[model samples]
Target: METVMNRIVSPQAWKDLADRLGVDEACLKAVAEVESSGGGFMRPPSQLPKVLFEGHVFHRQTQGRFDASHPELSYPHWDRSKYSGSVAGEWKRLDAACALDRGAAFASASWGAFQIMGFNFAMCGFDDIEAFVAAHKQSAEAQLAAFSSFIRRPGLLDALRNKDWKGFAAAYNGLGFAKNSYDTKLATAYLRFGGRSP
Candidate 1:
């Protein structure tokens, strides 16, 4: 028998977040579509939340101690080559990082729908990285709550409200946003959802 994937974000939750953020519902939906459209979890027995562990974060979290001994799990810079590629593969990387340093491991992964990095647990109003991860694993509602808290930072909320795709993508996705075309994709997704940010 296959274990079911847990998905529990409601339509109202999205609407509330959009309204609370002062952006159009379509703006928020476009973000969700671009970030994690397929829902948040790996199917089956493990049922782990979808994550992309950043080796650079692990390196920073651990202060570069594992750089030599475990270069794959910890690196001084963002190196896309270190990724394992699949959800299951990412879990394996997370597990390996956990073995070396649990806190750093959790801090290194980006979790759930918005791909909120675990290091932002405090910003998202979680007491700890584990709590953040637990909430993300529990349901999409929890993920949205984190996203709502996260986007409220200084310029980020305005980026969404004003439909400043490039600004939002840069702030949210890092300086590397353009490399992935995150801005254009967000614009396309927003338009696909019927435009209008306010």
Candidate 2:
């Protein structure tokens, strides 16, 4: 069987990063395991792909072209710039893709192992996947920052600080129906990581 330690890219590196982030090492490691599976191109499918493909997903809306059929808020995945198009076709294609692109069965554009959604990259600071990955690879510090953004950016720390690992995990995973199922595993991992008695 594979050991949990084997999954982690750099444990000491993550420890140092945890020091900088002001969170406990055990907590941070748990968060990392739950968030990015020990870092380096390792994220769950839904979250990461959407972050990575957000640009292409949004481009279907055409920022300056003229088209028909696209409407603001017409589709769940519609770009915020839906109204920026000169015509409706830009909006139409975006709408179609939104309707058809359910759960990444077709797009197949997952870039980073973390599978950060494409839409969030620009607003999150990184310009592209290559830059984000190259800078973060084998570097626990960078991965820590990235995971911090992924978790805390959505108010995850508020939940985590309250011993709400499930809530934090759910938030990190974007699941509205998160439960406390993973709490035991997380707690066990914490004790082990913290040099505490189990």
Candidate 3:
């Protein structure tokens, strides 16, 4: 449903960002690949940037006020079943949550390729969710830049550079990371991207 999804980042941009992040280009590529299948938007027709709504996050953002009335969109705990299981479906969830609480809704979802949470706008160098989402709509380069800034804020860059897949996954993906095998997937993708073992 989005009209602005014409984003194509060049290989040079990736390399340059990697250089600035002090990590191999392949390392960055691997995270991108594993994060959103190497693309920042869904397929045609609804090229909205990729996102995953977190009901638990919404609950926290709104202080659990809507948890009982809108358990589907706001829950006290993380529940995988709450997911719509597709890029478009996530937007639907976000839209519904937005109707209840716009700011909380925006802050509850992870946005773009790196899947950075909207609550992390400050960490990603944005003053607010509107600016964060605007950057996501601008270009994939903005998304990549946000990812770079995000990792550095939490000091995940060293974990990524050193190939500490487990540590990186645990920190970046949260508690359910191991359940999804994110560490192994990241390692496999990193190696596939020609990242040397560290």
- Candidate 2 to truth, TM: 0.47
Deviation of model 1 at 181, angstroms: 0.8
| Model 2 lDDT per residue over 7-81, tens place | 344667666656655566677666545433435443322121111223234334344122234333233453446
The clash count for each model shown is 0, 24, 0
The candidate that wins on lDDT is: 3
Candidate 3 lands at a TM-score of: 0.93
Best by TM-score: 3
lDDT by residue for model 3 over 1-198, one digit each (tens)?
Answer: 224435666788898998888888887888888989888887766547898999999999999999889989998988989999998899999999999999889889988888889999999999899999989877788899888789994448888888888888888988679998999999899889887776
Against the reference, the lDDT scores of all candidates come to: 0.85, 0.45, 0.86
* Model 2 superposed RMSD (Cα): 10.5
Point out the higher-scoring one by TM-score: 1 or 3. Answer: 3
- Pull out the clashing pairs in model 1: none
Model 3 lDDT-worst window of ten: 1-10
